[model samples]
Target: MKTGSLRFANIHLQEGPIGLLTSSLRKGRLSQTYIFAGARSVGKTRLAKTFAALLQCLEPVTGPDGSAEDAPSWRPRPTSDVVSVGSAEDAPSWRPRPTSDVVSVGSPDACGKCLSCRRVMAGSHPDVTFLRPQGAEIRVAQVRQMQELALLHPYLGKWRIFIIDPADRLNESSANSLLKILEEAPEKVVFILVAEQVERVLPTIRSRAETVLFQNPSHHAAREAIARVTGRPADEVARVYSLTEGAFGAALNLAAQDLPVTGLLPLREAQVRFLEDLERFSGQVQERVNEAPSLEAALAVVEDPDLLLFPPLLASRKSLVRGLLLAESLPAAFPVLFSRVFLDVLDKARKGLDKVLETVIARQKSAYAAEILKEMDRQFGMAVQNLFQAQVVGLLECLRHWNEDLFHFSHTADETWLLNLDRKDDIMALSLVRGLGFAESGIQLLSRSLELLSRNVQPVLLLEHVLSSIGGRTP
Candidate 1:
């Protein structure tokens, strides 16, 4: 019930995959193999270690009485710091008391004063073994050695524990070898396999062990921790938690700094500017398609995928979706031509979406149309800038092909297009916004139109003449 007790109490196990492991433990029927799966930094490895410690703790946990509790004085370390374990004589001292904080098996939760705890924490525990690859992946040799060690009797405690920090990192041969042992694991021997992505582990391995899933702490939990550690006001802590995307470690790092966590100011400013420019020109999108640097600045804000920054390209689609939704609700006289054109641009933008952009999809409905358009414009503009002149030329050509399809839609007729003449005129005003060579033609206009766009100059005057010729304005 203490502030940090839930951290180690395995309370999160009450729900999700972690709950399965908790149920098994309460029944005194622990699985020989267990996989802890989740995203990176979401606490899979951390939970695996805690489960291992609980299995080998000298003191019986007081909960369900599946096992008798050890006498008082054995308690787990509240953090990730490991407690080294060496021998059986240290067993009595190694017992860890229940804690709210989640601690790994190798962490200080083992009571370093005990011989077993000291050896394990120091990475020299005889009965405790760790099998990890030396480089990019875990190889078969490591698995072979593990097999050899697993068959041996424990040198100290009643049980021997093996922890594979990144179990999914094992190569095919190594995984198969480990799976063989799991199929026939000895009594009193436990294997904890920690994986960021469970599906990557072989199905045979997955089927044998109990699975535990750990979610990152909630934003509220992170904010509270930040306040406690930094003595900062709740408002500042709340702000930092928002910036960190609810990551506990990230929030803690920022809170520890003497300065406030407002370093993201530049990013915010660039996002704001990009959005403002987009909205101001939503009705004249064609003229402003070349703001590359500003576009790059927009993408940079959410570079860290876990933080879930909304990218410019995805933002564009959201804007179009909103516009489409609005168009559906508007009067028949309202022109939705610009929204249609913007939607065409968005359909093509999805091809290069990064993970961060995909995560932002859920927020699209809540985002403003103008804001989405701005982000997309910025990203597309920047992308065009990065390409060679010829590549950019080719892209515009492709865009033109897509644009030509729009004219055939029944919605582009005079009656519907006239109300939004200012926006429609800009498109009609262009020398050529359609047909086979439209990409080539579009590129030619880009340089000239971009300059005019930056100056806030409207070239739609000519568009009005063209629309009038087609009876668009009179309708």
Candidate 2:
């Protein structure tokens, strides 16, 4: 089959809620209302859109008698970059050859070449409507408009499909209005609700529709699907899969980028210094910025290669957390290769952790620990930065990632599960320094620093306190 023939809905319909849709289609038991539910970025909206297109297809894959038949093209023939469906005559007449066997659940479908399908796919179909969140919630007015549209007969297609994306975003008034439609919607209309969190949707709404559960594709499935679309190398496809948490749409976004995402230049140096300095439990992390304009240098080094890195000269605290998570999974560790370099420091940190864990946790108490982490996270986001504070957060985030990996390596002895698989060599080298005990304390040290920063503690003071608490040199 040619590449474009792969309609996403048909890909794994044999499994999960998709299987039910296929069964319903074959048995001619289609639901007027469907709720497609799943994790974020796991194809809920894509599935909903494709299903809506199918409902609007003039010659759907399933024939009039629901018999096995030639599937019509699911994609509109290339006319213009913009869909701008002009006339029915403009649709290409290419039809997929019929299969003699009973139509399988995997039947390719939703021929897009037809005028009706093109209009729906192009989002120009007079009968199809999509209601999404305005800002944080889907307001009542949008539902009223959709309800008004539902009363009209099909302008050019068989069904009037209203798709509510992130269905959970529907406000109370909107949800009640939607419930009214669910109770007595027009015969030719279909309602498809796509949501990441099914629980957030009103129960009244849920009771009136067929709930279809979508799922995240397996790593292998993600790799294949993305590779088929992008025609990228296997390694590149795998990398994208890892980065996007296996969401096809998210994967497609990054695959379109000019280059694979590498962290800003300082990410590398900062990561290296953080890991190296931990071995000494010293003040070297600050030393990297000791030179004037060095902070600016680090900030400058954070170039925008592809995947939006902390926005131009602005790094949100949220981005730092994301960067740390990236460091955990994607292996950005560099610079630290020799275990001999930081052995003494790692030893110092463990002893210091023991002493401080008692004193600080006692003096500051549990409430302080809980409150500080939130404060540090909040402050990092307050302003642009007196001096690339967000960049500093990013650096420490990388360090935290290293400590996590080392802790996992020493305790679990499973490198396969390591997030820094690319930095396996460096991690292994560092793993030999004080093993699990020190790695655990190192994690605590970073955690404490995060909390300390939240308590209106100066960054330098926080760094020095961590160093001292962890029994490290201050210089």
- Stretches of candidate 1 off by over 4 Å are 1-22, 60-124, 216-232, 239-246, 249-475
Kindly provide the TM-score of model 1 when superposed on the true structure, using C-alpha atoms: 0.44
* Worst ten in a row by lDDT for model 2: 73-82
Candidates' C-alpha lDDT: 0.45, 0.54
Local accuracy of candidate 2 as per-residue lDDT tens digits, 357-475: 23433444444456654532233223213223333444455456567877888887786545444455656866774467776877888887776665556665554444333321111
Native RMSD of candidate 2 (Å)? 15.9
Best by lDDT: 2
Error of 2 at 456 (Å): 20
Tell how far residue 139 is off in model 1, in angstroms: 1.2
